[model samples]
Target: MSTLLSLNAQSRDADHMLEQALQQWGGERDLWIFGYGSLIWRPDFDFSERCSAHVHGWHRALKMWSTINRGTPQCPGLVFGMLSGGSCQGMVFRIPRDYGEAVMRKLWLREMPNAVYDPRWLPCKTLQGPVQALAFTLSRQSPHHTGELEPDEYRRIFSQARGIYGTTLDYAQATFDELQRLGIADKALQRLLSYADCDRSVESVAI
Candidate 1:
């Protein structure tokens, strides 16, 4: 279909842009990626090793508006983003050097279709050691950025928002559960989980 081809082309273009961003910001060694959102729970990628990691000057917030995959433009869903602030705890994945470019392309297609996320290589402190990992963060200037929303606004959206990917609540719930399994407690996500109802979070397995 013409639409499919257009999407593929768009993905390629995004990958090209990401390559440029990394060229200026990435380190010169092993490829590591920092994931704090759904990628934390469902990293459909191949990596040699993964470990708990933390990055300073950034924290996760459900402040990005999803026009697709999770909601429509008229009634957008909220998604987690790495925002500038305090430190954040997340998962770091180490990819084999041979597969770095391939994985970067895949990641670009997945996370960089728009300017909502600014891809950058950030220093992540992993238990194994310190690693500079590529991360997708919120662009404060982007139209899709919501800064912060009240709990009721989050609950309203989580209850009704769904897209090709699934419900917004499912995404939040899965991330919360995954963090628990990793023994990494994110109090912020937990608060949203409470608003989203952690009691029935198991039903959010769809994400």
Candidate 2:
């Protein structure tokens, strides 16, 4: 199938999900979204305020298979997902109440094209205070969740997997760079990038 068609087919019931979230939110205050990965650097939507935030019970992990954005079906790439356990430090964006629905629609289109994430209202702590923010988390049982992979397999996918956006290596690098710029430390991600970089260097020498 064509890329556009495939993306459309993979989309979840976004409108319904939005409605559910809205009902649960009660239109009481601004909408906050906790971004852990690409959203940290590439939040395509406008926001009223942004802050460094922390959320408990979920940690950033390169555990989700990307079939369309970062790789193909035959060579799936890994993307960052919020998995159960520990905590995560990231950015939280607040959308004004008037723009909440519109911003949410855009977010769903970008992040929820596939039904891999379980959207949840997570409590996040920022310097200003604590706020409940929307976060996309993955369940261990989900098919897209890659619990672990052999080193060779991981390197192969990282080096070779490319999708409509770009290579998985580039995506990982971008995330790592952004986190560093924000003074956030993620040793696991740094190690993964080191390995990928070494592999690429070896390939260049061989070539």
Question: Using TM-score as the measure, which candidate wins?
Answer: 2
* Model 1 ranges off by over 4 Å: 1-16, 22-28, 198-207
Residue-level lDDT of model 2, residues 124-192, one tens digit each, is 999999988988888788899988877787789887999999989989999999999999999989888
Residue pairs clashing, model 2? none
Candidate 2, run of 10 with poorest lDDT: 1-10
List the candidate 2 regions with Cα displacement exceeding 4 Å: 1-12
In model 1, the worst 10-residue window by lDDT is: 1-10
Clashes of each: 0, 0
Give one digit per residue, the lDDT tens place, for model 1 in 49-97. 9899999989888888897988988889878888787988999999887
Candidate 2's TM-score: 0.91
Clashes of 1: 0
